[model samples]
Target: MNHHHNPPIHHHTTTTQILKQSTTILINSNHLSTFFLLSFLIFSLRLNVETATHSLTSFIDHDPSIKSLLNRLHLPPSSSNHHSPRVKKPFLQLTRVGTLDDDDFFSGDENPDHRFFDTARNIKKNQTLLFFDCFDHLGFVNYSDNGVRVPELVPSNGKVEFKLSESVGIDEKIDADDIYSENVNEGVEDFLKRFELEHHEMSALLFLLGVLSASYGFAILGFVVTYAWVLGIVFVVVVNDLLKGYKSFVRTLWDGSNLGLKRLSGFIVMRWAIRDALTQLLGVWFFGEIEDQYLFFKIFVRLKLMPFSIVSPWVNGVEKEIYGFLLSWILLDTLVSFVFAVDAWIAMADTRKSVREVVKEGCHLLSLMLHPAINLKLLEGIVCGSFARWVLAGLFGKLFASAFQSFMEVYFMVTWLLYYFSVKSKDANASGVPFGQRELERLLEDVR
Candidate 1:
């Protein structure tokens, strides 16, 4: 009998190790300033969304003392067997006493939060609590629909029973023309003339289009094609930007009356791109969905690499969320930004020479492909960017939402340039090339 025992798996510890190692590589690789600019421009929307979301959710106010006092008075539960909670608290009570017709029920007050908030007084025992304002008149009440007839709400034999349906007393004002104007643009001129409204509302309509473009468009493609869809989007958006940058680059390369493919590694660039996408997909899976108020971004910046905690303190409440984001961003996302900064400077110094050097470096890229963990971290930035594009764009603005998406396009090429140079520089150092003088001169000659 063969007694070959397979080793047991250690999942948690192994995952932890991988995360730590990946984090370290993210910090050590170059391009910090660029990452911070991208992160700040992009993640700020998420930060605001996080804060507003918290503020919105906190509108539900609960008074335990009042509940306990009522309990001591032996108040009977609204229903026998007490399956659903019917013991209404004082804060949830509504102010109006008179019976409301369906018209009154359908036509709710314009300012429910300000008027009906804590101002609601004594609740009737026979009456059911349908609407409530908990946070000092702030809007945090939930009104559910029960489908009961309107006449049923009138007191019957001193016993008032009302099962709440999602009926609120207020009707929201919506511009029908604004919604319909997209597919039918002619309606807008009439709408503006009819409503006596300004073009400011047009901004909102345009923003609405952006929302549809990002979400509807992304949902159709992002899920159906996955990675390939992301690639297509990046390609479409950055092709112009890359061409603009590449113009000066080409002029510098061919200025000497010679054009050579050896000066650029087409195969190497393609390989890196494919590998980078795979690494990015892995990073997205590793990081998972960022469900908790920018929690993933928060944890990444505070590590030894970024050190954002020095300027910011870790406070409790919502402020802690921001601090965590700053701290976490420094370690995980800064490397590529630093790499971009170096590449930009190098390109600016000598576009032609930089191209040749990068091609030379690209040939040796395989030798330095040992740090996929770092690429995983870089991919996380794109994930955050995607959230900005699809989720926050509607909440914020289209331009703001598109910032990171735009950054990712520019960033991929920049990082490629940096990666080649970093490896080539390392190899050059091994060959007794002075790290500070030789590479620095090549990188900064245009500056001089």
Candidate 2:
């Protein structure tokens, strides 16, 4: 039981087993590496071929004139008289030389009457002739026993100078005339249609302007009526207050004393402060709020009649929010104006105070009314109120100067986006490709 047992005798050779395992591993690794290397080479070659093909196709497709030139140069015998026996000898000789005047150079002649080589030499020297020669090579233009005839090319040169019969030239001329006349007639018809469209557009614009003028007139009339009613109420209240004071003041002044001068000066100061307060408040309330609301309503109505498909729903929502905020501000301002008017009426009625005290009170009221909401403090009311008045006056002054800068930034951004979209839309339409939603979104994102 304690004795150790030997291993089995049916064992594999260690060297053979190691050699077979190593060979198999090496072969598999080599195959995988070779496969990967071949794959990489094929992928790179495919990419290069695709890039080259794309470039070639782009060039050929973009230039119609080049395509036409190639087509003209490669026409078949049935469609082309380019190998005419008459010019074959000269044509072959010239092409074989590889350079002009080779024969003349070999003959040692300086002046070789190159005018005889005018048609061929001109075709070689002039680029314009290349276009015509290409057409002729395709048999679009052909030479008879007399000369060449190409009705399409005639307009480019004004007239053809070929030694042909009168009847042949006349026939070619008639055909060219018919083509030119057709082109002219088409142009005239297009011009007439464009003119009519422009005239109709102008008429529509004029009618819109007339309607706008009428609307503005009505708005102005409404503003005038509102203003008159408010002023009338103020006038009645002020007149009643002045009548109550007239008896006392008139008698005191008739007493023939210079003491009335002090009272007069105080009255003048009080009146000036009241006038200034009214001007500032009404300007903000009427011009900034009421009139702005009227204009906003008018603009909204106009936009509702416009092509809504051209505008995004998000933009419409933003516009509605803007109008809502403006309307709320307008209502708040109207309430503030009414409160100011009531305060003015109350001050006018109070006749117990001395003129100096009235002047001080008027100045205080004006300062309190003009002060911004941010600075209004409940604690240290008198001291904080005075500071707030001056601070708000300075803030408003700065805001006035900065307003134009803010407006300009908004204007430029809107105009730039509009112009970019218009140009992109036109280019896409011209290229006969419709833009996808993602592409439009990307364009808007870039603009933003």
Candidate 3:
């Protein structure tokens, strides 16, 4: 006898599931076009093109001062006074709002978390307050466990200050002078001893884990193909860095300062990368295997242009060799990741850090990198972060991936800005003048 079996009845959706579905739909609908456009601009702009901008620029502006401040901050200042200590010092300061338009993604005003809001609210003009870990009042030799360096960024204000203290002090002798000198060394040492203790940068570490995960994944994908592919990826990243003199290829395209110009410039750079990759491939085919080995070494050297290298392994052997190389890569990547964490502080605190200074920071972080515990965490972080990014990409797709990637790219951008800012600050501090209205003009010209 034939028996008819009814298909299993479907269960009704619960309120929670329906809400989640609706929320997901809303997010996708709202941000799909926005992220898609950003991706198009970011990737497409990597190619260089000629662009023209009319006088009708949009009112929205990209004020990196706030974002830079937040990205570089590792912890709350030990002393609240550090927040605006320079207001008392930067006499005759030339100040602007230094605010980003609401539309800019980094603008903290709209964020519910209030973390960036505190930073955005307090920044004065183009100036930022920075704390130091390795240096003390007595400088290098006084490497006190508690030393904190609070350096301030003072922009040009079109006027100069002459220190009359020496002239004024020459005529007046104070009883405190002799006492101050006698106790100066002791005072400095004591200060260092009282400084805040060094600690881990949890936020920066988290950020670095995410970046290194992608870097690790990219490197693995390279292994799956050939080492040459990994070098190609690193080459693209480095080339993007070199092109920052054009300043279009870094950060989210939403800055939109010179939208068309950036797109064209980025497009040109992208073309060069494509051409170079093809040429390298052709050379490998024609010039023999030596081309592959040369390309591998070439990437290693070029990466030195930045403050630090990610230390990917040279995998060209069986299971034993692969395991050895992978272990070395993990150890090295741990140190690299720690340095990256310090870099967040460097980003906002001093946008003008030299590669030499970056090297210095990397050197300091070596102590942390050597710890056995952190070494293990590095491997775990890489695997977890890479998996998270992969799952995210699989779920949300290329647009989301591009947006997330933009955030990491900005971390690198901070170092470049640090190089530029450090120079600008040094010159301005030396000159003692805010270059008048010329200051803003100079920033515009530089970004262009």
Candidate 4:
């Protein structure tokens, strides 16, 4: 009755559980610093563009002529206005991207009761009225809908006619032919010159200095981040070349050309570099263009390519445009990912395979991308992170937002690269052999 129970034995598995595999890869000390440096360079360059634009726009907003025009037009301030109170305002002037408010008002589609027309009629003869509704600027219109009211600002009395040039019609598209007269163009050019802000040579020189700093910073980052990969790729190509030459004399002669023997790795790196540069350029250009609400309301309109409208009770045209642009980018990203997978297969996996075979093999990876669990994880990390970053920028400042953006960029790049590697490994395992690495090992064995 005095027997003591033996202490329970615990089993320990050799394989450690990775809490979040992607996060583990991202935080690796070897990669973290390089990622942050790259992010800093990117953010700094974008900040330059935003700074230049903000400087120009701030000048326009504070101009007496522009202020007078806005006041006389009775247009409300932009909902997305970036102005700060006097005490909090920076002496050197810091600003956010876009910062301009859009103008919209009564629309033909929404005013079935002629309320807009009635309101316009009541206004005095000399005053100009801007009329609109949400649907007017939305680009999708039901021409036959009974709810549509033709926007006519002329009052009942002949003496109170409002000229077309004076009235701001939100829905009207300006025809080039109508405004092409030299006299009209000259007058418009003269008007714009008054609002244009000129930069001193000193400011231009300073901007050039900032760009050079970013370039140097990026180059330094490349040494740590890209140099290893470049060397590895070159080594792989050289090993492959040596193996082919040892295998057959006829093939060795032909394969020299096939191996892309002339600056092979350099060409590969250059191509990828160009692709990356274009992608960044396009993204920055789009961000700058889309944030301009003044340009959107005055010059641009929705493309009408969407099958159905994304109607929201509270969302304005600018918000809708942002959504549209985001959706477009998502689609473009997916297509680019697929193309990248194919390119990766050709470059790293097997150059001898037919295009169709490569594509067929790569299709297996699509399942991974479309997996519900993975999709949810991506949404949580990317979409939520983006929203949070934007909110933090609004609440705190750009520094916090820039940090978040850099982190997110690292996450995005690591996630996709890992996905590619995982898919490739799985494919090799299914085929009952290692592929790329195994070949390299065999080449080493032959050399030995």
Each prediction's number of clashing residue pairs? 29, 0, 25, 6
Local distance difference test, candidate 4: 0.38
Model 3: per-residue Cα lDDT at residue 200: 36
lDDT of 3 by residue, 122-201 (tens): 22333223222222322234221112222332121212121222333433432334434544544433322332111233
lDDT (10s digit) by residue, model 4, range 265-356: 44345444544443333334444444333332221111111101111111244565556555654455445444443344244434455545
Better of 1 and 4 by lDDT: 4
Which regions of candidate 1 fall more than 4 Å away from where they truly are? 1-360, 373-381, 384-388, 404-421
lDDT of 1 by residue, 290-404 (tens): 3332232222211111111111223234464454454454443355343332332233333465555744434344345435425533564545443446576787785565555
Against the hidden reference, what TM-scores do the models get?
A: 0.23, 0.20, 0.23, 0.37
Candidate 1 vs 2: which has more TM-score: 1
Where is the poorest 10-residue window by lDDT in model 1?
302-311
* Residue pairs with backbone atoms closer than 3 Å in model 4 (clashes): 78-101, 105-132, 106-132, 106-133, 107-132, 107-133
Candidate models: Cα lDDT each: 0.33, 0.31, 0.31, 0.38
> Which one wins on TM-score?
4
Model 4: residue 119 alpha-carbon error in angstroms: 56
- Tens-place lDDT per residue, model 2, 51-70, is 33333334434645433332
Worst 10 residues of 3 by lDDT: 50-59
For candidate 1, the per-residue lDDT at 4 reads 28
Clash count, predicted structure 1: 29
Prediction 2 TM-score vs. true? 0.20
